[model samples]
Target: MSQIKGSSADQPTNAPLGALHDIRVLDLTQALAGPFCTSLLGDQGAQIIKVEPARGDMIRYAGPFAKDAKTHDFGNVFQNANRNKRSLVLDLKSAEGQEVLLRLVAQADVLVENFSSGVMERLGLDYERLSAINPKLVYTSIRGFGDKVGGESPYGHWPAFDIVAQAMGGLMSITGKNENSNVRVGSGVGDTVPGLYAAFGTMAALLEAKSSGRGQYVDVAMVDAVLAVSEVVVNTYDATGVSPQPMGNELRGFAPFNTVAVKDGEVALGAPHNPQWSKLCTIMGREELITDPRFDSDLKRWNNKTEVYEIVEAWTSQYTRAELTEILGGKVPLGPVLNAEAIFADPHFAARQMLCEVENPRTGRPARITGPAVKLGRTPASIRHRAPLLGEHSREVLLEAGLSDAEINRLVEVGATTINEEQVLIKESAVR
Candidate 1:
């Protein structure tokens, strides 16, 4: 533990709303999934103390760096995932650091980690050990696979990245154009989906802990979480002996639920069931086509999906996406295929506050970032603080741990901690 500097007289204020104001969280996770989960909790006023190894979280090196090109300065990916939290650099392998972690566990309401199966136990900080220190501490573990019961596979020990999980969890099977061309999802759905489940599980455990006056362990496996989202494909294979293939822009069980080419761009429309198909035909001035034996029912239209989509495209290609949207939008379900620029400029996104501007301390400019997906009316999510510089709050966090100034100086002198002096110097130089 390090000590406090600057104004030791001024105490740090709590989070604005303080929804989870008193709830202390020890975040021992890294990379995308687990960080994202804790970030969400931090947004709602959880006192998240991010315990980073001496080398820092791997995301610090994952780039989109500032003009100065400092590797450890907040990279875009790192900033996006880790906001509204305090960070402490500690070498968990060291006895002193492990003792500090144990102290934190004793005072914490939750301990979240995404280490491999046995790392916690190897550290002698597993649920069994920590529960003795604080019986009400919720221990949440995120892993690549479930270690309980017969669910543990031989690959449990092997490390996994987002791409590996996507491939192994069946997301790639139905994500591309055809059987030969399988595509992994563009985003880290495999990693993030599991994180989402883990966060939910942690919250549930907290609620339970309140009632039972005991803490429980939460196990969230990326493979299982990704597989849960891939249930449609699983059910399709189970119900019918046929495995679903990648069908680019086409809905698996519904007809006319695909993309159509317009004169200017493309639009997606969904005739979810039979009645919507009839409504679509009527709106297109093709009432006769609705009565045709080949397109009368949902099954019939599905059987002749190619021809049905071709007919729709013929009509669509004569008009721009905007024109078609005006003519048929919300009548039978329709939306234009908006690109990134268009999405940023969209009125709906603006109205919903889906995009927002946060001040970037490094750039000294407003950086546009995505707003919170989950909207709560009472306690709305916000970006109160900019992403921190490397070890920005080292002194403040150590002060919270009740360290003295001389002790912090000794730790820094001994090479156990660091600060972004270079970044501060750069900023000062720029101002001059």
Candidate 2:
């Protein structure tokens, strides 16, 4: 067997004093939400075993494949969400595979799955059964709608892509130019936010388990999570008895917090607070507007937002982003509407260590990827490894699970397990 070269055990350890370092996560998720949650855990130094189906996670094939790549590139999207974890492939439908999974569960601290509500129960790996093996395991389930609460709805069993959740959760209603033209946000916030909440819930449960000596189930619905983020829309309807319409590049309640044209490109400014508004006037060389009744108070300015924006834009359009940034540097919240290439070249991103480069052993090239969003000073998150090739650590992971070499080989022969070189090569060759 060819050794996998960059196991976490062999990496230079800056073991983050992260809160979840002691936790172990068994990730049986694919695509966006569930993997994103586990990625957060992995970033915080938790050990994550990403268990993929026999054919592998679908995201591996969802591309923008790498430049001139032959196979599914594991695209930037997958790489971004799946770093700092190990991969283990197993056929969950096989009896032997189920046995191996149960063995892994015996030692796991958490099990995260985003399959439809009852799938885990059908596979005999549901929270009730797994908790029997390890009573302290935190079992987290991410679904379109939670089984315990909303599973009987007609949409519950229907597969929900990100857009479906966005539309149903009120995000689409408030997203675009107007009421008739509801648009989805560019990113997968519907999936991503629920995953984030699920991760938070998992950690909270883990902390509780420490004292109670028992684990609990965490159920996060994508629609519920999206609704949580749509508080503004819900609150507006409740308070005014009016459904809010989409106002592109404009905030529903705030004035001068929207996009304004600069000399070259556009910048977004949020001088919502009184002091920030005053400071923004000073930055725009229009200090007199601070006392002008039409633009003085937040309420008055909100009523006349179009005129207020016109005044602000008249001043902003004359200056470059640098000039605007220098004027509003610490006075008001401001940022340029940067594109992808511009963001990659931006200094603030580099200074904050928001971007990092990891060497891809297969490509023998450095792959630049985004680092974890939150920065913890004491136990700062660090990238330990590039995203794994399919089944990259299968043998080593099963070995750690106490499986012998012959057992691993038997499973491999029976189409119950796979390794990186075999599976990824077929994928890579097909694309090439």
Candidate 3:
């Protein structure tokens, strides 16, 4: 490997004191799943050093950019996943870059990536090699099938995306209106769910390593994650020897536990329990159903769901979602299907702080984004900063890593690195 160089100045101070504050993460992943995994870590106060190629993470060019961004770093997807991490542009193809990575690995507490199984081995930076430099390093890999760290799957060598994971893992099998037309989930849970699992797995490995004075490879397959999440299908199939089919928005084994149409829109309604079902019958002015043999018990109602659904829908469809909400919101377990606008305007979201504002470099104004889901009374998760510009912290990060200014300049001069701090611009008047 070639000689390395870089310099660092004073680091920022606005970061929150999170649970993982002492941890250092070298993020070698890109795209949704891997980036999201690192982002979760970043949220919990890990010092995430995102290693990018000279051109930057490919997701940076994804569009739907902010209006004021002439040179857009990324759009909604990238922004959502890459926040609270510093960027370091290093071309791994170069020998110097590989050496630089190895040096970083020596000091990092955790290193995470989502490349295919053999990419790390090809780069000569696999867990075995990196752990040799730092025995306590918690190295995690998130992939479609999985790496050989635990045990290799039959499809370990195959490439996969969120849709592929969803399909192969059986999520799509029970996602649509019927079995004939299986649908992919709208969100990228197939990717991010695996990311979440990897985050937990990484933390667990880190904890064990602390006690044992040894690090272990933590691997999570996207397919496996989805399969774990959709275990109902597997359990149902295994118990009865019948493959599960999509029941649309309804619980196949529970009556009235489904999305019902209203005059204006749809609302999810679930009154499967006896008390709730009895109340629902009274509310619908169909109290006779309380004694009807076909609808008396939960099992009978489920068995005769077609008749029960028709009766419920007939009453629900007569009212608008708002009117239905007024009548049944507290009495029955129901919620209107909310769109983005509705969510933004909802008091519940505001009260919970589910949506939060951050300073946007493009407009130099506040931009609203989703807030962290987990809230710790102490050491709360927070968004310290927006996503970084390409190579935005390359020099600074290298400096913090103890490289001299001269070496930093040489790396930039040799076309091996680049830095741009001006990419993040906030107006002086804007509040943090």
Ranking by TM-score: 3, 2, 1
- List where candidate 1 sits over 4 angstroms from the true fold: 1-18, 66-72, 413-416, 419-432
lDDT of 3 at 45: 87
Q: What are the lDDT figures for the candidates, one per model?
A: 0.77, 0.82, 0.84
Choose the strongest candidate by lDDT.
Answer: 3
Which scores higher on lDDT, 1 or 3?
3
lDDT of 2: 0.82
- True lDDT of residue 232, candidate 2: 69
lDDT of 3 at 138: 93
- What digit string (tens of lDDT, one per residue) describes model 3 on residues 219-247? 89999999999986889999999989998
Clashes of 3: 4
lDDT of 2 by residue, 82-154 (tens): 8878889999989889999999999999999999867887998888899999999999988887668434566
Q: Give the per-residue lDDT of model 1 (tens digit) for 131-159.
A: 99999999888888755532667888878
Worst 10 residues of 3 by lDDT: 1-10
RMSD (CA, Å), each prediction: 4.7, 4.2, 5.3
